[model samples]
Target: MQTPVHGSLLKPLQVNEAVGVWFHFSHSGSTALPHLPADILKWSKNYQNITYGVLDTPFQTVTTYANNSCLLLLDGRIDNLATLNDAYQISDPSVQSVVWYLYVTFGIKGFYRLKGRFTLVLYSVESEKTMLYRPYLSGFPLYYQSQEGGYTLSTNPLQLCDTKNSVTPLDKQRVAHYFTADPLKFSSHPFHSLSKLEPGEIVLMDAEGVEKIRQPVHEAFPKQAIPTQKDAIYRAYRRLIETAVSETLREDIDYGIMLSSGIDSATLAYHASKLLSKRGKKLIAYSWKLPNDAADESEKVKALCETLEIELKLLSAEGMGPFDEVGSMAYNPGSPVTNAFARLNRECYKLASRDGIKYLLNGNFGDMLFKYGQPKLTELWKERQFGQLLLALKRVSKKVIPAETQVRTPWLTDEVKSLRKEKTHSETGKTDYRYALCDFHEDYFGGERYLSGVYGITRLEPHRNSALVNFCLQLPQTLHS
Candidate 1:
């Protein structure tokens, strides 16, 4: 039978995997829950004792080996497949097949060989063991929990509650941090049972036991900007952006963009213009501003879109376009629980619905690849006075990094601390940011049994595109800064 594909699948291995739509609040850990959704249950029953993984949603992917010994799900885009695809000998153009083949080809090495930001899961049948993992350098959600010894993984909290005994109390410290306006976001949640996957590490479960491995992000990445010295970074960046654009536009649907006034979106739009010029596709740009909010700069976004000569749709704190606002959020699934990125997503969904566009093309992680978050910190570290850098990091965390946002909380914090402690470590084969990068990837970039399980949209992040990742990994910090 031909596999029907959405973005990802929520294959309910147990009864709780089939969650009722009534779950409103987020919970911690995996479970065996009551009120399983019929669709989930019915789908699970369709599989033989050997289960197959499928997408829980568009961004969430679930895939079980044909033998049923394993079940897996992934979130993110792979950009470097010309060779990997050739290695897998997969003629099929779909990402799933390439991924499955990669799994069959190299097992965990399969994970290492791939690039992009995601959170994923891999379960073993023989031992009923589950493995969770995240990569060192990434910007994706990865939270996991184990109850009754059975592990559950996701990019979001609510998904785990679909199981039994999954609902637990929230962590007040995390809540206080958020309410008090601390920058620790996402590392620790109010709910117990959930744990963020440390960056650049893999959580593995087997008959013997559960384990984790730290896979470093850079170093293995050659510090060159392009494959050839003859190529200018700007021109190469432009071509690569075009590649990212084409891959995203692979889906057959109307599309829109999340227009940030910054260079990231500006550059993305520049390449998009070249792509759409011939097709006469009027790229729809979505921008947002704050009316009563604390911080917002939608006017810059408006100005940028105008400069690019692209169609623009402006938004306010009030709401998105004419689409049934609430319904679209319901449809997005990644919203609400997804935090800051979630709000930005709402704008995308609203614009998509308004433009009659089925697909929304966002260059979300382009900033990460470009190191767009805090320009001066990296520079400060390079200039010495690491003390000031640490203080600045702490200062930023209080405001910029949320207790929950991976970069703001544990991932970035640990990285900063480690960098301070491990001056000689990089030479001895131990590095700080590189280590954190690995942990972040395995935990969040859709690794074996990782967390942050949010698979509810036809989501696309090409910045981590394998080719883009490969290229970025080879660049000097200056390029990223």
Candidate 2:
């Protein structure tokens, strides 16, 4: 058996904790990180102790820092030496080295300085204090259980691999929300234990239990600063590419990028190709050839890849008929998001497995991360950063009236904002954002336990880095300008 990377569940102790929240705390309990090693075949008894894994490179390092006192697991790469040096006094040396330094220097507070889409855990071995955090709106899928008799956290549900702690099932109200909720925020999952940490949240857990103390996602969504309309679009657009490209390549394994004809993938592919071209390595590109072969974007895809000089790996959509069939036949909790996207991910996993690649990047979560749905902008925009807000509005407009947006047109129309609900702090008995964030929790993002069970493949969405999102969120309304 391959050695387990992280310490085996020496004991999958039944810890009653809380689930699904967006929060942070002043004084909290300890946290833990249980990460499997890269090379371990299997862990000790019941997979209790890690047999394999290390953090030597950026590609496939599933480094788990544990003790009787703590546990931390991550799915991201940190790239801010100057920030690190200024914050923790760790100079530019290497990512792993800096991680150790930061760990030694700031313990929990240091996390704020971390810049990536990493799903992290802090378990207090002594206090049994536990807390989990995904990057602030970086958009890593963080499934958790915050109820009696069960409290577990995992990057994806599959990693936990225990039925006792898995989801039990859900009620009909959640199903109703899943099917008809406006904007369709609630997700569907058959197993009961599942819940996602809302974007821009810091969850705290302890003996008493877990509570997501709310915080603002952004002020009224108008967004932060910008100097000009053109600058807003340019910065937002560039930030997306810069984030997606630089961060995902941190895994300690051979990595690949998912490519397709869509602007999203093309955009990622465009930047990746440029980066890989500089190094002597060809950007290993993977694409899913649809089973029907009718919706083929082959010409556009091929032309782009060739122009960029990227090495391509084309996988058949039907190649994994057995795995797909098996997953569908037994469990697959009718994911409301998009199965085609999941299938694309599955195919990417197959590509990784077949070619011995450990890490692969895909364009998932970009829609939510970038808020790709343009129409929502009018409702979300805050006035503090009008210049930046206008640029985002323009990009959003392109999606709404693509042809018309191609030519210059008057972008700001208050009529749209007038039609939408105002995000007033005082009117709803809410002055700070935590209230609405919690409202999103109780009413929308969390509270619904769906698909808390089932095997989910590991996917790297580098663009969901916390630093990038916070930068976007914290920007003045016109920063994009």
TM-score of each candidate? 0.57, 0.53
Model 1: how far is 439 from its true place, Å?
14
- What global local distance difference test value does model 2 have? 0.42
Task: Give candidate 1's whole-model lDDT.
Answer: 0.44
Best by lDDT: 1
Write model 2 residue lDDT over 1-481, tens digit each, in one string. Answer: 1233424422221211212211122132222124533212121111123222111111223445533334444444455656776766655454444554565576544555566545555544444455555545443456565433345554334323343332222332222223221222323343344555644455666555566633333332334444355455545666666665765654334457766554346567666666665665556777756554455445655666676677777766664333323211112345333334345555455555566554556542223333433222222222343455345654664544444232111222343224222222223343323321111122223111221111122445555444444444333233223
Q: List, residue by residue over 1-481, the lDDT tens digit for candidate 1.
A: 1132222143322221311111111122233223333332233321112222222322233332222334454444355567677766688644545555666677755767665555555544444445555554453445556554444454544444442232222332221112111112333333345654565556665434446555544433444445333235445655776798776666444456766644455667666765676666667777666565434556656666666677877766563333322221121221223334345555456456655765455543324443433333123212343344334334543454444432312234453444333112233354435332222132232311211112122434445455565565444322222
Segments in model 1 whose C-alpha atoms lie over 4 Å from true places = 1-61, 68-107, 114-120, 123-129, 133-142, 154-156, 159-190, 197-200, 225-231, 291-296, 318-345, 363-367, 372-431, 434-457, 470-481
TM-score of 2: 0.53
Q: What is the lDDT of residue 24 in candidate 1?
A: 16
The 10-residue segment of model 1 with minimum total lDDT is 18-27
lDDT of each: 0.44, 0.42
Candidate whose TM-score is highest: 1
Q: Which stretches of candidate 2 lie over 4 Å from their true place?
A: 1-111, 123-128, 137-143, 146-190, 219-224, 227-232, 239-255, 291-295, 315-340, 356-358, 364-459, 466-481
